[model samples]
Target: MGNAIELYDWNVYAIFAPFFAAQFFNLKHPVSALLATYAVFAVAFVMRPIGGFLFGWLADRHGRRMSMLLSVGLASAGSLLIGLAPTYSSVGLTASVVLVLARLIQGLAYGGEIASSHTYIAEVAPAPRRGLWSSIICISSMSALLVATLLGATLSTVLAKQQMVGWGWRVPFVVGGVLGIVALVLRRTLSETNAYEQARTERQTGSRPSMMRGIWQNRIAGLRVIGLVVGGTVFFYTWLVAAPAYAITVKHIPAPEALWSGVIATSVMIVVLPFAGALSDRIGRRPNFVFFTLAAAALSFPLNRLIQNKAWQLTLAMTIAGVTIALVVSILPAVLAELFPTHVRAAGIGVPYSLAVALCGGTAPLLQTWLATSGRGDLFIGYSVVLLLIGTVVVLAMPETKAKPLE
Candidate 1:
């Protein structure tokens, strides 16, 4: 639930960027301002690796609950700052500076949140059902994106363009900030996982277990996570986060319509996640990943061709993309968690995973928008296919963890 709220706060910035870009940057032209907005969006990704390492160390050294508490508090503070950030008109470049600082905070928190939560779930779940349990992450994540899209659609429908630009864009940020407090409260009830407890208890009485040492010991496992995450994060952000904006900006689809289409597609994806996770448990993690890579790679250009400046077409494109995406995301956390022992699990996932995302997913929106603007959208589609194929190779190289025991 805390993950859900944190994602909502993070994704809301992407959804509302078209409306609020002019408020932060001096760029007056719509495309220019939008591009500039995406630049700041990528800036957050730059901080994610640092956040991931910092929070992962904290989680391993202290406890998952403590790490979560601090991450959520930081996220809430960031959201509130974004909600009340001064405009270009009021504070010149200071507005953009505040926006950057806010995103940096969020980047760090989200980086830690993913690694800790994934580690927590894999540790607590029964071995045979770990895949199914891991789907909760995807459910929370997709549901957050759905809610952000719904809220964006709702506001765009009710508010005038001027009003949306002036203040409506801030509503979701404020809501996210307040709800983050509730998540922090809920997270306080969490206990350390048994695996972590055991790992700590069995250690030599005199020596402090080093988080960095644990990560170093499992360096190979961390490398596997980085390979698997690169394509998954890039494709997910491209089709889910960047798709609707592409429709509205490049195809000239209406804002409300494009956003509402994203909501519907995301809703369907959420419904598919648990079933996909269960299937991975029944079969094996590799097959689901294989299917997602093959299917998403095949769908890239065909789905892009399907959108024609119509809401339903956009819906059709994203719905196919989302369902295929569900196959991978539903099991990915479990797959990554199963790679490392509990002693170094969080940091192992955090370091390499966050680095991959910062390099790929963080740049996806800007890359997609630029391709569309330059009339080279097909090139972006090709780029996605290439990444998917690389992911396929990585998935095949890794052993099946379906019945593997955590150390």
Candidate 2:
């Protein structure tokens, strides 16, 4: 539930970018305004590593529950601020500044939420079913994407352009704030993970140093976590956020149709994610990642070309892209969590993952836009392929964690 709320808030901004861009920036150039909005989106990612380290440390020293509760509270506050933000006409630069600040807080909360939640879930789940349980994190996130897309689509259908640009875009933020509170309520009932408790007890009785020192001692493991995350995060943002804008702006597709394509693609992803994760449990992470990445790299050109066709073709192409994303994202939480020891697990997972996200995922949309504008969309594909190949090599180098005990 917490993960769902986090993704919903995060994706709501992306899905509503066109509308919000017009609302907030009031720029004459549509692409420029959209880029500006995405720039703010990217800015929030800059804080992710900070959030990850701060909350990861809190989760390690204090408790996951406490960290989660605090993070959610911060996210809720940010959402409310966005819901209530004034337009540039009313507040000048203050509006954009406020929006960026609110997003920064949201990014920070989200950075910690995923790593801590996944770590907590992995610790509690039985070894054989760990993949299945861990996949729920993606399932919840995809579900949030589904909701955000649907809401964005519905609002576009029901509200006039002027109304949406005026106040309708704020509706999702208000709804997100309310749902964030509900997630907080649900989180209150969650028991502390036995793994965390055991780790805490051991620390109290043993001689473990700071999490930073422990991470330094396990630098190779930390690099492996970063390597595993790079492909998944880059592919995810590319297909989901970058593709829609690319379809609409560069390909000159209708806005409604482009959004519908995204909606269909996200729905397919939700269905396929759990199955892929389950497959990884049965087979192994390395093999699944290898197959998925190779297939994706091979198909990148064909898929992008197909998506530039008619609306139905676009939907089919996006569905295929979502399948490729599901293969990587569904298994990532479990794989990353399994790479570290319990003592520095939170910091180990959170910091490196956030770093990769900041470097790759957050910049994906902007980078793809620039590449396409420079008459080199294929370059973006090549970039994605290189990351996936790097990740494949790293995955092959690492040991499989299937059926391994969480601790």
Clashing pairs in 2: none
lDDT of 1 at 265: 94
Please identify model 1 stretches exceeding 4 Å from their true place.
Answer: 204-209
Q: How does candidate 2 fare on TM-score?
A: 0.97
| lDDT tens readout by residue for model 1, 69-96 | 8888888889999999999999999999
**What ranges in model 2 sit over 4 Å off?**
none
Q: Which residue pairs in candidate 1 collide?
A: none
TM per model?
A: 0.98, 0.97
lDDT of every model, 2 decimals: 0.88, 0.83
The 10-residue segment of model 1 with minimum total lDDT is: 200-209
